[model samples]
Target chain A: MSSLVESTVQETSHAPAASVQSASLPRLGMAAPAFEAVTTHGKIRLSDFHGTWLVLFSHPADFTPVCTTEFLAFAAIAPELRKRNVELLGLSIDSTSSHIAWVRNIKEKFGIDIPFPIIADSNKEVATLYGMLMPGESKTETSRCVFVIDPVGIVRAMIYYPLTTGRNTDEILRLLDALQTTDKHKVATPANWKPGDKVIVPPPATMEDVEARLNAGYECTDWYFCKKSV
Target chain B: MACISSQGELSESARKMLAAMDASATPEDVASRTELPLFRVRAGLREMAEAGLVELNEEAYSPTQLGRSLLTP
Candidate 1:
């Protein structure tokens, strides 16, 4: 990864675009694909977000009604996300000027400033890297996708929603909370789990463990199921 | 250690430890919870103790009220 970063700095032609296009979408529990692009905030690299959990999401385009509503929703939760040590980065196949104008329009009309950076990926370099382009949806526009990246840069969670339907931002925040909770407690979240809810413990692996789990005082229906507050 | 939290003022490791910690967490317990190494957990506990974020009771450690405040918004 250091070599990739080094070559990216030393030469502009080292990472071939053809090779980039061939790469598959990043898998969960694997490192996220790296790229740098001009953003509304300024020139920035993916590495700039190292050491922090990042929500890297892409929309079909900016200034569209659905995308505008999503941006405002994301903006409303910016401070809460910051409290959890998470940073938001948005992307689309739009130019920097267009991104800036859209941001300004959002601010002027909605009276809400987007607190995060929006990557201006005009050349589709980044769009292809993350498999954001869905020809079934639109060749020129990116699909609405979200990648929840951990502090160590792994792609922990991914979600894709159709362009016509708006995304539920609360679920994004809930997913982040679940991921962080799992990391902090080594526990799994049950369906529709929320903060302060009892976390699911790992099931027993052997007979002795199973015997112990039953007598271990967790709220268990059987050796295979257990829940406890961390 | 860097004061990583603007509100808690605890270092990053300390905050991680406190967030994962219950009233009766051992160093190994917290190490697994935070996914931090035991050595770092021990060091972070010491930092927390020094800052009064946590207190040693019996063999387990618990957070002070001041520390609990940091865990909330």
Candidate 2:
């Protein structure tokens, strides 16, 4: 995935424009904000993941039922994410003891060991900095948010949900596949894009390029909108 | 209406509210549907009413035409 991004057009400007949209949420093609936090593994900094893809996600708290279900889901998929060189980091406004206890509970009840470090954001400074605190939901807890950051510190994707729901880990993995595919091929993902689905060719930025793209044999609704069977 | 602005298109919250509307649910059931604070639920209900997505009668609530249209499973 990192290599794919490297081959794409050297678009540094796209990253900053994406940074604004992803200011409070995770935005793709933008740098992830740096942070240092205490985790189950020990103190770690966001910079530690300087050269690897990262999935930095948050949960409201430990021992809660919904969060328990979500962590289990993430745990189930951790190995698959690891195969893709994506490190997973979980966060919550809980103490270290609380996080450990929750991990123990998961192990005992679900018979699954959470393979990744769960950040114990006791003070929630990390949560606040990441805009995880949704006052409309609960001031004391964080919402379910996922940030995908590449090796170069650019945020590649973000997903957010209201506190009522758990995230779709399937969707996250699908998105990763899609983003990687697009970066490698200079294409895009269509609606409900899955791993093997046809890829979209990014619309050209100029009239001549648009005609050239049309002549390139991509499926186009109009000259301005073109998709490829990649 | 813009798809993004439509309440029906907001699958995240719409799913939660629909799950809460079950007759078997109690106040605790409602709370479990979404992790929202009590005030947020009240606010959402008010907003839904204004959007013609829900109606309140006899201290109970039910989806209106617009809401039902959005909840088509």
Model number with the top DockQ? 1
- Which residue ranges in model 2 land beyond 4 Å of their true spot? A1-28, B1-73
Per-residue lDDT of candidate 1, residues A11-115 (tens digit): 223333423322457777766776766666544566556567889999999889999999999999888888897889899989877888999999999999998
Q: Model 2 - which docking category?
A: incorrect
State residue A61's C-alpha deviation in candidate 2, in Å. 1.0
Best-fitting candidate, scored by lDDT? 1
* lDDT, model 1, position B2: 25
Q: List the residue pairs that clash in candidate 2.
A: A28-A156, A30-A155, A164-B34, A164-B35
Instruction: Give the 10-residue window scoring lowest on summed lDDT in candidate 2 chain A.
Output: A1-10
